[model samples]
Target: MKTKNNIRVGISIGDINGIGGEITLKAFEDSRMLEFCTPVIFASNKVIAFQKKHFGLEVNYNGVHEASQAVEGKVNIVNISKNAPKIEFGKETEEAGKYAFLSLKVAVEALKNNEVDVLVTAPINKHNIQSEEFRFPGHTDYLAKELNGEALMFMVTEDLKVGLMTDHIAVKDVSENITRNLILKKAAKIHDSLIRDFRIRKPKIAVLGINPHSGDNGVIGTEDDTVLKPAVAELFEKGIMAFGPYSADSFFGSDSYKKFDAVLAAYHDQGLIPFKTLSFGKGVNYTAGLDKVRTSPDHGTAYEIAGKGVADYQSFKEAVFTAIQIYRNREEYEELTSNPLKKASGNNR
Candidate 1:
């Protein structure tokens, strides 16, 4: 809820057995997060108790039943879980997945009801969450489906933004998925998001090819020449700054990616591999083209170092700050366009 200045952010506690709780505690360790916005963690008191003892960190926690009752002085938690499941650090269990799903569901619902301005998610284990109750591939898919299937996962650093044409698919199947319509749609979405969210008017996008050397002019493959080139050309005609059916081999090596605002990778690893290599711990995995603003750490749920108190909080901190920035930008844009007096205060000419 916004009261002229403060924005309330809903945080979903990710897998308890992973580094979700650990990094969450560490991320908000700074007092600056509370100054700009209030965070309500959709978790339980028992989960907090477990994390504090397991990580050997002392954090002042306040239990609140509703969003309005939350206090900015401490970490305000909504006690959603009645009985915290037996949490074993560094272990992936069905129970952990269930709680993670529950926390996210509560957070999403709160965001939908206008109780929160943005959603900041921690990491979750896909293997553990592939059960009867939770069948989504990951948080992006779940949020997309919940928000009427209008979201795409885009990874972002200060310098780079990477959007996947097809994520979480086998390398062999990636070729078939590179169609003209899909490419055009994702490219348009990326362009729109750059203008609306990132505030970039003429966002340049680099489209990577599916084959080596961009199909070597059809000698190696034809998808790059037939599908990618035509798709890019069509977007160009529409006045979008779309470039290249670039060869994946040389595109990232020469730092050619620095020329574009974002890269539309043909597949998952195509973009993420290089992105993670460049900005692994500092990057933010943002869900673009969504009706609601959402962001997560680029890394996954590190179950190995779950309760070790060694989980780095850099990415998580970045995600929260990014969400807050996007939310504020959106709010400002709305206010600027909606107020006729404010709009006229600038040059009418």
Candidate 2:
């Protein structure tokens, strides 16, 4: 029901020792970005100054103590910490992890309170960020819990959209996690996101197999045949347009994914490897089915080149753009659904 001309994007400056700050600043280097959206980075002024000095950057940001005090047309730094820990590039310390959690926690709180429209998170070191405060595997789980919604790790790009059924779990646990209900839930989220977030009508979803050759007609494994096949059939019966437990190995190689609107992979690597391989620098990881918009770059914290100022920001930029677009799409969808004439007009066009 609420709408705005300029989207307020809340950003969580990920690991202070990593390339998160570098990429966040680089994404806003082009002043043209501020024309559409205002970025509020949940970080301390000390950390920003340290990184700026290290990179020799001369960017201007509005340093505010609260989210409501954020200014448009500039990077808004919401100071979560007074005296930031010392700068230690290319190093993983407890302090870096602590700040990373603080940044994410504050940004998410702002998002929950509707202080911002969407969230674009920077790269976080999984190992370092694991403290008593944040015990989840990654951002997806934390965001899901905070927003009171399920998270589908949706890898989005111009070429394709891939969603994982199981995320951040080990190989041993993947099989146990792949249940009929899990598949159905992820497929529904991806399907709903296609229509609501991406504005796709009549989405055709492709399902990837858990085993090689879709379990080779039950000669290898029966999960794909027994579990996945029935799940796809159920989805199709509900008018979801879902198909196949196709062999993961050959599906991408054959370029068959071009025919579908989105693909549901059985596990993490089964989906991400191919998605990242195709759109390594440009892909955006959208957490679909969340009440609020949240997205991240496909890549992680580049500790090797933390202070080199060479980390690619294309993916981060795309994540920001994707969050804005999804918010707009959601608003438009609500407007159309509320009015019969507008809904009819939209369908006709």
Candidate 3:
């Protein structure tokens, strides 16, 4: 497939009414983003203007109704709306949710149409984005359902890479969702993603035990032995390099996580607690296994700090860079796979 551009990135404005727009503008303040790829914003010019004015950001916007009008030096807006909702910092009204959802929809459509190479989403409010039209717990679940259930949420930091077997679920109901199929599926997605996106030839994945001490041989909890163990065994049979039903507590302390490319957790807090503690302001939330690349900051819409212009862009920066790296790696992988290798010349010599 011949793309019109080398790498056109589609950025979705998560919640214009919140700090999503501010940090997005801050991210674009680094003009070097143009060096990597063309970026198109799936947001209304009005929203961008409000954010720029409200937060005193200096970035310029060029309203483009389509991707064809995208150009460097200015933030290219797809102009999903000309007269969208006004800026109301820290608000979670339905209008904000609707706008955020529309932005994501446009970005996803652009990716599907090959108009963009990768996607980097800003933080969005889960409760506000869960209405009749945009009823989803979070971006991960929303994207997974939209992409025919192909995405898995993975938290990535410089030190730790974690995957939640279940994301955005109730703490009480986590055990009910911990079936062998679910565990294996999340593991397979993470494994394939490590190889295909991260370029890991052989991914070593660690599966965390749902109970303490990995159930102490079924003395603490049977799920760790019966459910997690069976899934790990199945993954091993499929030639996937995976291990454990490890005690979550010791898994991180022993520096055992250093040995694997990624760790699979049974639930949301199981994985995120450690990840966030280590990288509260710098973690990248990546949705792996999607046909197109997508990433976001691990944090949410900081309503308290809205319009303060103090929100750190480190996570956002990491996400954008990570997305670019993944896109390039996948592109390279496809190129190599499609071409044939040459035979050695030693015999002829």
lDDT of 3 by residue, 251-320 (tens): 8878898998999998888898888887867899999988878999888889888878899988887888
What TM-score against the true fold does each predicted structure earn?
Answer: 0.94, 0.97, 0.93
Task: Give the better candidate number (1 or 2) by lDDT.
Answer: 2
Q: Give stretches of model 1 more than 4 Å off.
A: 1-5, 339-349
Q: Give the clash count for each candidate.
A: 0, 0, 0
Clashing pairs in 3: none
> Compared with the true structure, what per-residue lDDT tens digits does model 2 show for residues 153-259?
99999779999999899988887789999999999999999999988988999999998889999898888878999999999998899999888998998999999
lDDT, each prediction: 0.85, 0.90, 0.83
lDDT of 3: 0.83
Q: Which candidate tops lDDT?
A: 2
lDDT of 3 at 109: 82
Ranking by lDDT: 2, 1, 3
Model 3 segments more than 4 A misplaced: 1-6, 342-349
Winning model by TM-score: 2
Give each prediction's root-mean-square deviation over alpha carbons. 2.1, 1.3, 3.0
